[model samples]
Target: MANSKEPRVLAIILGGGKGTRLYPLTKERSKPAVPFGGKYRIVDIPISNCINSGYRKIYLLTQFNSASLHHHITSSYNFDHFSKGFVEILAAEQTLEHSGWFEGTADAVRKNMVHFRSQNPTHYIILSGDQLYRMDLKAFMDSHIASGADITIATTAVNERDATGFGIMKIDNKQAITEFIEKPSVDVLKSGNWKIPANARGDLPAEKEYLASMGIYIFNAKTMEEMLDNEFTDFGKEIIPRAIKNKKVNSYIFDGYWEDIGTIRSFYNSTLDLTLDHPPFNFYDADAPIYTHMRNLPPPKVNGAPHIENSLLTEGCMIINAKSITKSVIGVRTIIREGSELDGVITMGADFYENEEAKADNKKEGRPNIGIGKNCKIAKAIIDKDAAIGDNCSINVSGKVYPDGENKLDNGVSFYSSEGIIVIRKGAVIPSGTVI
Candidate 1:
């Protein structure tokens, strides 16, 4: 482990992706800000992970629909004024070097080398902005220095069936990565499996399963700066794999549970997983609490019947009347009407002041004025802000919201809502009594 005299660790969160998979939700804001776990966005998971890991110096790289994300960061996180370490959101501005948005994950980091230089960090940790995990990164950094390696990529034990879809690794006795394969075939190690044998590296410690890259990385300052100079744009595609053959790239096998909510089905499943009897991700741990950009809102007020079960209700939520809620995640300022039904769904209140640009363009403009309508039947759905649902609107009741349209998501899992779903966009209003 590296010495702990407060080593300078700079974390760059890649938040520029247009998550089309979680559409309607991502339509108005960037992927990270797309609401998750009821009151949080997928981005919060990573930000909180950083917070939990004792990393205070952080930079968020964003581009498409970055306004809301920027706003949320400012409102939720305010440590910048008093701490030696700070957390900030840096949007990719158009300069002579590049005129458009970030090209890819590596490009995002490459463009922000100026930020790293300004921070004068000794280590650079690049992370997927939309992943879910809780890690003690301080330990990961210590190991990086201990191995005397140029770069260290985080790895986790996974079923090959699950590992094959991710970057697989073969590490040596000293934890140095021996070989690399991206999204290998199921037959690479075992049929119906996707993990690389831990013993393949021979030096790896005992574990329950094979190790796979988690897309999290730590690089020696000089090594990362030099690698960023090339044409490599995507980390997994060009950076890590290519660096394995040249630089001393190693792996830190992580045993904790980690999940990437990239696709709609995967994203949906991650949220539902929080309801598990023993959730893989525990947010209640005071010793290791997930830090995130806070929403600066008042805690919720359940005015009417307060029947919440296996649900995550955030601050500023108003439940006018409800018999009981089972398996639901409700966002801030979200209001549920009288006699309404909600099951396995995410809901939020919309504010018009935030989307002035879109509102001016007359895009789904009706949603900003009102809240979700009274007595709307919702199930397995994701409802965005300022969206109003009419009375008695029954969304995907069976969780299959889209029966006709071709879902272009990687999962091709059709509609994200298995019990049926409906997205009201930023400002669209669902007419009263309309059944979607």
Candidate 2:
């Protein structure tokens, strides 16, 4: 077997399409570029994992709303001139051969084969840019090489409730995956044939009968080239299933904290969970810290230290005599005025500080300044960057209050609510005495 350290590995992070499920958040930026946690972008999870696992040469394939993603990547990850390790963005473009955007995950990589050929890597690691997980890629690569297989998939055991959303698989005693089904129906799972035999279950929970694909894969360079030579557009939907019948495919079972932030509900819930005493996914790990753009803003300032419990406040925030803040993630350059109370909120904070002139202009133009206005009550909502909420406005009103689906509100930038979570659009201005 070849030494895991000796092989050259290239990491490819798949920037997802339109991201309609994460609507307003993906309205202006790509899913990966959306602000995550208090400060980092969603893309940082996979990129950080790659770096921590000692795989530095990485490429991110982007298609929709890539401008902000480009800026973020160029600004955040800067390698030295002497090192070949770099993070770059390969956007979809029309060439002489193909004149279209990335149709799916596999097609995205296939289209960028010209660039991949130059790197000449021994193995390729494919990852999802928008998921939240910290994996040791070196270990995963080692498992792939040790399995003596051309392609290896990283899978996690999930319960029946979550099984229908993922590609479920059945593996043999040798850890070789023999059967694959994408989003199998309830009746299909009830057949009891897809469940892994008890002897082959390994250390996974007994309740998690199905192994769901985590959308993470490792492919031998030659095998990837050969697989992409065809017209298959998706790995999970096409390439992978076909490869299982012809190639020796293996599964690397991962029992770790992984959350796919696909919708506004998932994003909001996962983010707020960080404020827990012990979060499922830890961002405070010193050995493998999550990295992001270093804005170098000053430390957060609390005026009177008004009630703050189970919250994360990032740099450059001014909490001025707030009544209380609980179970929230406040972003950079946030200015919470006096008498404002927030619970279960995730504010992306402002991009740039509004100067005295900007504030004067806002006042003159009959607008509130950038941030939460005074005496406002916000609950179960996401306040986007540069959102101006005027004083005495009640947002979302109650924790249980949510629209059946999506309800559009008109005021400043016309805010909206999805799955009961109110989202104030970026740069939106809610006038005084406004209520939603």
Candidate 3:
């Protein structure tokens, strides 16, 4: 067996972001801290992936609107304190050495490089804190080493129509990337030449062939330093663009479910995906499990609600007297009042106000009492914490719901519950029998 002399590998999680796109949810916490899959936070996915991948030395970089994210990381994740391996979180702080808010993805890493080098790992595996996917990074690293590539990127085939926001790549007979374009123009969508015989699809970009980057990367420690020092901070917009010229940049094709939950609609849809019979993600894989700081909460209690289908209910949640909740994710301690009906909605942890000290100033400030309207219906909508809706409110206001509120009315993204989700705003309440 190989001795344990291998240089420690570092998985640096990029958790710092204003996450303005996910505003109301991100207003209090960072993107990753946004509650997900009923019980887990968005950050939990990548952190869990790292632990399951056998790389215990991890660093989470977070900043801006991060109080909740920071608190979650500290209280929940406690690796073996006595063991050599551990996971940790780092936030932006001011010091003479270097201090400013994280500007971009690459800039975030550049700001934290000092802390990273201290780990002195043989390889650096960087991940976006807000994507949802599962893979064995160790195997990806082995492939990187075997191919003798300076940098390895994770890629997946996406529909050509949906390739607008993603970085597109063109490969050749070998898995080596030949040409790369960052969010190519529609007119520039040429048939990509990148092809690997071992792949399920050899012909590059055939009819619907656009290979998109997953923004996951493995870098030789030295290679990363040089890349960071060269110019810009973003790997997608800068580093990889520069490396494609001379460095050996390769791609690994992953044919699995992957979603970028950077926006509200996407976030809401992604969370809903977990409720499918065969969910796109499976946390049950013991061998490559996603690890997180566990919460000590009792099991959920579903009282009098019809048998749930295509929904995820977390610990300590009580569903009392609700006739039905179809295709939704409910967070801990959330209560669905009797006679209320829900469909394709997400009620996150702390979603209700419940007239606590926090809401003491509510009435004076016009904050509505926290409770859902009785005998009302919510479909394909998101109701934020603390703002109680009147008994007869309508969420879809209009017939159609679109991101950024396509109707351009105040209803706010009728379908988006991610960043900028309809905020009940702490302490605000809707009068009974009213409609919003």
Candidate 4:
């Protein structure tokens, strides 16, 4: 079953930069650690994909706000003594040679080359931590080896509007990428030969004319070392374009449910899409299941027969007499109290349940307990972990307009509004009858 000539591959996941675009979600934890699909973190997708693809030796590189991410990874992944596989994080550090934070994706990997070299991998599979997709990376590596490429980029056919936001690759009939342009303008796209060749189109849709980089790359170890030998900070902007000139670069086209959870709008839309009857991305596939920390949470409890429809309620939730819950994702250990209505909402849920003492303390402070309170109506919003929403409050109510960006309530509690959705900050407490 083993091809002795096949190169040993190691996976590298780039935990993104400050993630300013994601805003309050990335305020405390790194972007990869941000929770997704009610139960899993963003990092879990790529890590699970790697595990399913038989690549277990992985490294995640991050610099800012990594404490929660570290905790999540350590708690989730553990291999047996017989296996030489491990998932580790390589945070940016100050050494004699490098004293600054990871300037960009390429720089981040370059700084950790000393550590990765110790593992003696023959090639590297670079992935983004915040994307949602299931890929057979073993097959991807096989394609790379068969093509005898120094660098292989995973690309997906996207429409013209979406193509401008990504690095467009121009490939020949052999799937060999001949040119690379980073975020080309519309004029350049119309004027330049940026279209994929007809022979290579295969099953790609006719309207999807351009091939956009998916930020997934497989690199020969020597070629990667050579490419990172400079001060080039980024791969798309510098490293990739330069490598295209001198290296045998190829493209692997992927046509699947791939979503870059880069911005609030994209993240919101992607999460809600999971509530569909047949989601584009299936998490229930037993052959390639997504893995996360096993909290051993008990099944959710619904009392008084709340009306529920097309929602994802994770483990350890108590739904008590809710008026209705529609098209939402309720996270672990969440509590939806009596007479509350939630629609198109994503609640990250509480870390730990509030005992009697905690409830008493909350009562003394005139704040609601850590969950949605009675008779509240929340819609098109994200309730972060351990947030307390008091009774009879209105959030993102129908026909009620609210300004976007960071806004504070009269009680000094902070919440964020982006793309017309309200985001209750983690550990925030909204007092009784506060309307927004």
lDDT of 2 by residue, 1-436 (tens): 6576688999999999999999888889999999999899999999999999988999999999999999999999998886679999999999998999999999999999999889989999999998998899999999999988999999998888889999999888888999999898989998958787787677888788889999999999999998998999999999999999999999998988989999999999999999999999999999999999999999999996569999999999999989999999999999998999999999999899998999999989998998988998999999888898888988878444655444555653366778778888888878888888
Ranking by TM-score: 4, 2, 3, 1
lDDT over C-alpha atoms for residue 339 of model 4: 94
Residue 295, candidate 1: Cα error in Å is 5.0
List candidate 2 segments past 4 Å from native: 1-5, 398-413
Kindly provide the TM-score of model 4 when superposed on the true structure, using C-alpha atoms.
0.98
Candidate 1 per-residue lDDT, tens place, 160-226, comes to 4666677788776677887788887767756534334445434443443567788889998898898
Instruction: Give the higher-TM-score candidate: 2 or 3.
Output: 2
Ranking by lDDT: 4, 2, 3, 1
Candidate RMSDs in order: 5.7, 2.0, 4.0, 1.1
Best lDDT among the predictions, by candidate number: 4
lDDT of 4 at 42: 97
Clashing pairs for predicted structure model 2, backbone only: 402-420
Q: Point out the higher-scoring one by lDDT: 1 or 3.
A: 3
Question: Candidate 4: misplaced stretches above 4 Å?
Answer: 1-3
- Better model by lDDT, 2 or 4? 4
**lDDT (Cα, tens digit) per residue for candidate 4, span 397-424:** 9566667779986778778999798899
Q: Count residue pairs with overlapping backbones in model 3.
A: 17
> lDDT of all predictions, in order shown?
0.72, 0.91, 0.73, 0.93
